[model samples]
Target: MNTTTIDKPATTANAPGGPVPVCHVIKGRVVTGTDVEYGPARARFATPALDLDGMVWPRREPGPAFDVPLAEIMDVLVQTGERLTRDPDGLLAEALEFSVLTSPLPRSVLERSYASLGRLFNRRSMEFQVQQELGGADVLDGWREVDGAPSGRRHRTRAFPPRLIHVIAGNAPGVAALSVVRGALTKGVHLLKLPSNDLFTATAILRVLAAVAPGHPVTRSFSAAYWRGGDEKVEGLLFRPQFFDKLVAWGGESTIRGARQYIGPGFELVAFDPKTSISLIGREAFESDAVLADVAERAAADATIMNQQACASSRVQFVEAGVQDVDRYCALLQARLGVERETASACGNPLASDLRDEIDGLRDMQPHYRVWGGYEGRGLVIRSEEPVDFHPDGRVVNVVPVASLDEAVHHANVATQTVGVFPASRKVALRNALAAAGAQRVVALGQAAMFETGISHDGFYPLQRFVRWVNDEG
Candidate 1:
């Protein structure tokens, strides 16, 4: 670890009784100004404005990071991570304190999230990701000989670092950290457009890198700022291929659709499209009272990760059970949803009014549909003969009864990102069918939100897409 003394800089400058000042980081330097802009108002607090033009890096050439060895970059990141964990009142802490105002997640949940942010920067974990995704670190450092080619000619290739504008999602604070780590490991020049929901995390991490290794290539390669998603003045000029090679977007339908128009010949979009996850519970869960309790807890774990705000959190569960068994499972699942966990809180943003109304309507539908729990974020479970019409959220899980596990596959489509299956053994039987049905990942019933390092996200390895492949022909 670097063990450098960290300075506690004010993240925001509040002008007496005015809105907080949100500053922009250009490369490794922080730039603050009097120019004011406010983000869309949320339930809790409003976002402070930033200088958008200051964030634009006019240089067209690659930065020093493009030439540095991958190992050196990893070392800087590891030290930065250590510093993040060790510092009691550092940038990560500052971000957590500010997050309470901008984010809907409770204080305890945010504390838990900030505490684990350092783990994403592990050295061996990063090495594994590089090896798994891009074959090895050698390709990133320089060109390597092609193993097999159809033509009788020698060729070499390198995974060139791209100039990227990451439109990162703010649902999980971890996304910001992961983007920085990925951007650094790939040696890319990253300009992260911070989401309104999470405005501080990425900038704080970048600031830590600046403190740990001042003027380091990795630090100079990163810049983070905030601007509304569809701001044409900024997007119209910056989205061009001359400025950035790709826009890595992570958000819902509106965010993706907004970024699509900017894609063209030189610039492209690597989209982590909005996706929903489901669960398939085998009848074996009901084999015994102890088994049912354990299964319910597992199902709840998947359903309530990040309070069902994460893309991997299970929303709809298909169970191979009769009415009595399924109803019992729903009751148990509802109770478990309110239990606190590392990534979830006992309560979250209350269920949306429309969703609450939908549940209320289902209540009158009687035997055809049964609703458990309510809108206060204690979690809600609805048991129905078929899938519900509205999307489940706010720790809500819809339990759909099916005669066989195979019947659940029909409900999954291209939008499905993960499917957690019970009885672990059944995953093998359903993995192929689930993938064929357009689902990207399958895991044990309780492991939907537990992702391993180097795993593919949204059906592709993101790090592979973050770089450009340049070849040398001989």
Candidate 2:
């Protein structure tokens, strides 16, 4: 492991320092790291030089390693942990202000960010700013009854101002931003271990935070830095009794499994779990054939975002029998996939290698699973000649063949994350069935990922899962 440093004054707004290097609390010691820029995104780290915008960018003159001793490192972690477990109010106020500023992010760019975490981190920053400056709308309040209160006596409430250890996965962008914002709601001191794939987010967010609250101690309540997620030298050293109160993670099977190393008695593990999504078409989709084509165009739009890598993006599809009538459905979907040309978006890191590996293995067995669109950019589509298999691949899309709407509902297994139902009525049957089948979200066939703020990801109303509530039992 290379321990690198650079001399950067804290006044430089371009990265992490200009006069004094902007800081975040980790454990509670003042360990410093500088910003490393990459393409359109930037992150904070102690690395001397970095790959930025297709060139090598070194922030400052290199120097010898700063081994401040393990004991000191322990103090930073312990102190920050103590701050979160003991007093979180002041820090939360600052975090809230920053989170509110993040809501105005463009859906288009948000779509492009995909696995390149810097963009996702940017997304998180966008959400963080919105929450900090404007406070996101109360998600749970949308279902008010005539009296404007809980529908019945089911008015139960819980508040968890818990300290957190965020295990961010490099799989998607903006994930770290989400975890960071969640920690801030508790005003909890944070120990952020950056995933190797998208390391720039913490720096971008911290730099922004320092600018937003230059002198606030809440800035000291969190320590956001970059380190490999599986470096057990660091993990074994820090994932102990007094270091954290909760471990929050987002990713696939390996990531969630790896995060468990830091979990025990007082420190709990909260995971997003492994998930997937798809679309459902209804016969009413052809209320008019032209309308069906428009719906087909929009459905293609939903699938193209982030190249359908998101758990919220559609992958497994079910079409109505009466509309395209199975054969026509496949033909229409393929035509739509070709016409809409969803595979044209920019991408990074090429989706997950594991997903690609899965496709590589399956394509050898299923000839129908051939790549059917332009083979560059986000222009590749995968279609099934048989019920074959659905292994997600790089910017590759799949159009699964189902016998009927009823069979479509039958296929709503545990892998479903979001399902877009056309005609919207079939949703009455398919949505609940898929919900029972383990889906996290359901939407109009074309609006899978664009369901507004409160629609729910997995099972949590984000505000509830990501924030704190003070209830005075007066």
Candidate 3:
């Protein structure tokens, strides 16, 4: 495999900061962030259990980046399920804590943070509502509609049924709210785990819940904290004979691999696996080069959405009727995207550099490549005769121009996540083909990133993934 990573300027991780305690809860199990020391204001989460011994968590920035010790967490998850009878709400309450803590980031701070992101894939609206509830699912209890008998039949049915642990992703600022909403509505208590990339948000959400439901069982039933995803030490405990009924996570390869090893005997895993995305263009793209330009730009924007970190961001394009037509379309597409700078939070030192190198390497592959912008600030563009083979460290794209949508989509790998299209009709022809070929989701040309909260992910409605079903036959 071609490994191209941009090298960042070296900086000390554990400068002078002493032990900084941040509370941690994994698989709905609580652990104070006591022993963890801060280190590396600049690093990536490649492993599990962060070693903050020499790290510094800066005040202005989201501090201390490190791996959650997968080995350690596996141990916990392995045993967590069987012990649920003892403290069923333990993990659920912790996640609630994280969701509440993260919801109210001072407008000034996150707006600035969002601005610093510089050309991200998705943008946040000024305001979003957070609905917190209980009994439906200790975690998802507050959804729009999720009760066994519905309406007035509440007295006969059991409320707040158990079974599920969620590991939340911080790719979007308000994701914790959504995840918690799902679990709560599904009636599952969450052992919500946060990504270090956006820990402040989770912490913010949790802080909110603690005040409102301080004494409730479900209130104490949840927990929110961070644990490197792959850590088996704690996570593994979930696999042994019903430690937890379910494990839900939003992750890529490394995190998935870690999940695989620890699924205990009676436990089930509802995974939203790591998938890639792409866009399809029909000869209909030729209808109006102007419209094509808009579509292309939007498609590219979809590719870079979430800095390309989101599984749904489009990565490749299938241009119909190749040649000068496709080339001209691509050129105009480039022109439109040339100066489009996004308002996204910049991932941090080494990450930016690493992503840049991946983009550069792809550019190098094609001698006909025409890079439009500089590597530093905003509006960065890299153009190739066809889309090149760029690695997605985030904020970079690998585009290819195919003669036909069929030729283009055939490249769909097991990782394909989203596919953008120009015409609405073509989706009918090729959608089944995509599913058979392993593609997961498809959206309109410009609407890829705006996936609604109501739709199902992959093949199933995720609320089902977050909550367990209990049947009592009369």
Candidate 4:
């Protein structure tokens, strides 16, 4: 581990002459910093240099050294998961808490997100995802024969873990952790490009991995560093096929666009594009007085995942009901959105100044649209005629009333990611249309926020796609 100290000036962002030194774990070793950069939340923090030597751009070779057995890797991950579960108050968790606190999200929102992330860090979930993605761990070994081959010859394939660069999103802490899990499981050497909004969770996870299995092969194959997203000197060197083969990016339009310039030929990009989720509630939701509130609560649950910041979190809800029933459902949804929950809650994302102004403007134009709830960081719903023109930010939702679920299908397109359908059975009726419209996932009503291991993210098994599929033929 390498550590460097820098003298702090009298006038600093936080405390007087206090240095907030952050470590970027590079290939099992910690690299400290002497350079300071103005980071998120107006805080001055150490910026560690990118160690691109044998770590990021390694000499690509065929062997188990770069690719460990799946069982052994899983064992190490199980130990890491156990530590996170058993010792929540341990040093690693504390570091994560501190890092999360510095984010612009409200304390309540961060608390809820972190708590939800804790549940996802267990062994069962990790193992399930591994099975879902790769079918079994043996595929990593090389050329496992797929069923149904030619008479004499054989068709065999393997998911080869290539050198990868994971640009992680910070909206939900789960993304960062999941990236590490995928990278570790694939046995890929990773250069995790930590997002500016979050620079802590990955480092903390790395530390836990080191603690759980000191000098383990899987633990040593990872590295993390931060630089301005478009830093030419850094990206130019690392983006080449010689250095890295794949870039797994998770972010909004800007992040995806930035990675595009460096993508071509041998350099592949597995992009989990920025997307908006929606809820389609059939008229059945409002069919009876008995189930009205239940449907609304589920719809609220779908919209409020990660306080509506997650890509899979529903932003638009198409209620296939009469005007009165739609109004009633909207009212119920507004109430449910304000209730506190471990996964999502009322103290949601704080609306921006311009958004507040826009909401205020829409307030005057009634009937066309009605704004429910407050601009005080609670949650807001706009009952609009069609889909709202602007992409809603914060905890704002746009409830569009439709004549039927078919009409709702027209609104969904490639940009739409997840669709939570009411009454569960409705998904069957609408699945083909939703899939044709480019929606990746459609879940049971109110379960848009819910996740399962091995679920195809963006219509593909991510782990299966992350590796280099090599073939052997006679």
- Writing each residue's lDDT as its tens digit, candidate 1 over 341-410 gives 9889998888889888889999999899999997898899999999998888888888999999999989
Candidate 4 lDDT, 125-231, residue by residue in tens: 76787778887777875568766666677778888877889999988778877887888878888889877777777787787788787778887888887777877
The 0-to-1 C-alpha lDDT of every candidate, in the order given, reads 0.85, 0.49, 0.50, 0.77
For every model shown, what is its TM-score relative to the native structure?
A: 0.94, 0.62, 0.66, 0.91
User: Which sections of candidate 3 miss by over 4 Å?
Assistant: 1-21, 24-34, 38-160, 238-242, 335-374, 377-390
TM-score ranking from best to worst? Answer: 1, 4, 3, 2
Candidate 3 has its poorest 10 consecutive residues by lDDT at 121-130
What are the runs in model 1 whose C-alpha is more than 4 Å off? 1-18, 40-54, 58-60
lDDT of 1 at 429: 93
lDDT of 2 by residue, 72-150 (tens): 3233333433343233334433432332223122234433342232232233343544354324422221221223344
Show model 2 residue runs off by greater than 4 Å.
Answer: 1-160, 286-288, 322-371, 385-387, 451-455, 461-474
Off by over 4 Å in 4: 1-19, 54-57, 60-67, 115-123, 146-151
Per-residue lDDT over 274-298 for candidate 3, one digit per residue giving the tens place of the 0 to 100 score: 7778788888877875777777667
Checking candidate 4 for backbone clashes, the offending pairs are none
TM-score of 1: 0.94
